[model samples]
Target: MPKLQNIIVLRTFAIIAVVLYHCYCPWLEAWNWYKCEYRSLYSFIFETVLVGRMPLFVCVSGYLFSHLYLDRGKYHEFGNFLQNKIKRLLVPCMLFTGLMCLILQLNYVENIVGYGFHLWFLKMLFFCFMTTWLCAKYIHQIKLDIIAICISIIMMFISMPKFLGIGQYFKYYYRRDSRDNGDDAR
Candidate 1:
């Protein structure tokens, strides 16, 4: 398939939103390096972007993943796909998390879960790809997508275990709610 200009634009927008949300939000002091002085304006921008920024990123990712899997046929082989994702996603997350721990003088073992502090999106994407691949390869039915989505909705209401990186899903929802309630628990 030809390059998608619209997806590229959406990605650029998402990236800018993420940068603005992280770099300007004064309330999220744990994540922002330098908080902007205009708290009300930045808070409005932060709230607006928080709703759609990551979902836009994930939508673009799903589209690109579909393009590669169906058009390029690059991900048909399970082992190759796994290796590619590990290289593209997992390796960088591990490296960055380690570097963060080192730079912050944090204990590596205790801060292992802190990998998700900034890098959770990659880990979540890794799991999403694995699940998508399994469904496409084995189930091989259109209705499976519906089923998976329904299950995911149900899963969202329940608490995900705080292990194997699945907890990030719950954390995302929890953090959104907590932020709305003026509780910055991090």
Candidate 2:
């Protein structure tokens, strides 16, 4: 398969896993499926499938980023590439956030704050792209592939409570109300 095709497959799988995990977690909790008498083997399937779903998505993202930005030729294409990326990332983010906010106002959803949560991923992606670009431009001679991976790992780790307190703050303040329930809460 072509590289682009591979990326697409990976991206699709990651997205599906995330959606399934999110959807399943609620069902699992709402029905107390885990505690069901004579729990079926499907319970094991659900537990295994949804476990670490977000990390799989993150790994796929990292893989795609490596494929895109690690090469010298791609670095030369940075201007158009970055512009396209910003448009692709930011436009949908803005549109979705606006639509969700409107839905909340119309009482289609309970929390406007929660609907705005999807923007967090886009916002973080924007910042990551910008930071990577800056590092590539000004910090030439530094091996950016290693740097990118390191930075990505660091960012991911910092967003965890075990390391930096920043992650905890982000979880509390920036997380959406829809995710406020402990099961789906990031």
Candidate 3:
């Protein structure tokens, strides 16, 4: 398969934006909250990037997911897909989160559910993949694009509790954005 240069570039920019957002997040206020030294222009900058930083990343990811897995609007090789996602996303998330918790002397149990460092994105991505798998498997009546849109709209209202890394869903509804045009190359 040919490499997607534009996606590579967009993903690079999204990663940089996410890194900068996190670097300055300590100074921004969240929905529930965060400890800010004092509100400053960082808050404005943080909020500005916050709106689209992860969404940009998700858009690229969705594009890639479609390109890789959804051939002719059908997902194939379920077992292989699940295993690859586990190996590529879940395992790394666990190891890095665990390592960071140990090194930082933080509680593993407290941090593992998508809160240890920036590794939460990995866990959230895993959940997004799992959600796609589920939708592709069971929701055969409706079109995936329509389901994605519905899920996105539903997610905007409900704040699911954090458990088994699911709070990461409500924390950021990237799963709701699985139909981005990242696969325009196809």
Error of 2 at 150 (Å): 8.4
- Candidate closest to the true structure, highest TM-score: 1
TM-score head-to-head 2 vs 3, winner: 3
Q: Which digits, one per residue and each the tens of the lDDT, describe model 1 over residues 1-186?
A: 588899899989988887766565455453444444556655665766465776677778878898788778889999999999999988887788778778877776554564444666777778778877887778857787677667767765675654546665444422223342331211
Weakest 10 consecutive residues of candidate 2 by summed lDDT: 161-170
Please write out the lDDT profile of model 2 over residues 9-98, one tens digit for every residue.
777877887666555544455333233343345446655755554545555664566566665246446778678766987667667766
Instruction: Tell me the number of clashing residue pairs for each predicted model.
Output: 0, 0, 0
For candidate 3, the lDDT comes to 0.67
Q: Name the weakest run of 10 consecutive residues (lDDT summed) in model 1.
A: 177-186
Please list the C-alpha lDDT of all candidates, in the order they appear: 0.66, 0.51, 0.67
Candidate ranking under TM-score, highest first, comes to 1, 3, 2
- Between prediction 1 and prediction 3, the one with superior TM-score is 1
TM-score each candidate. 0.81, 0.56, 0.74
lDDT of candidate 3 at residue 166, scale 0 to 100: 76
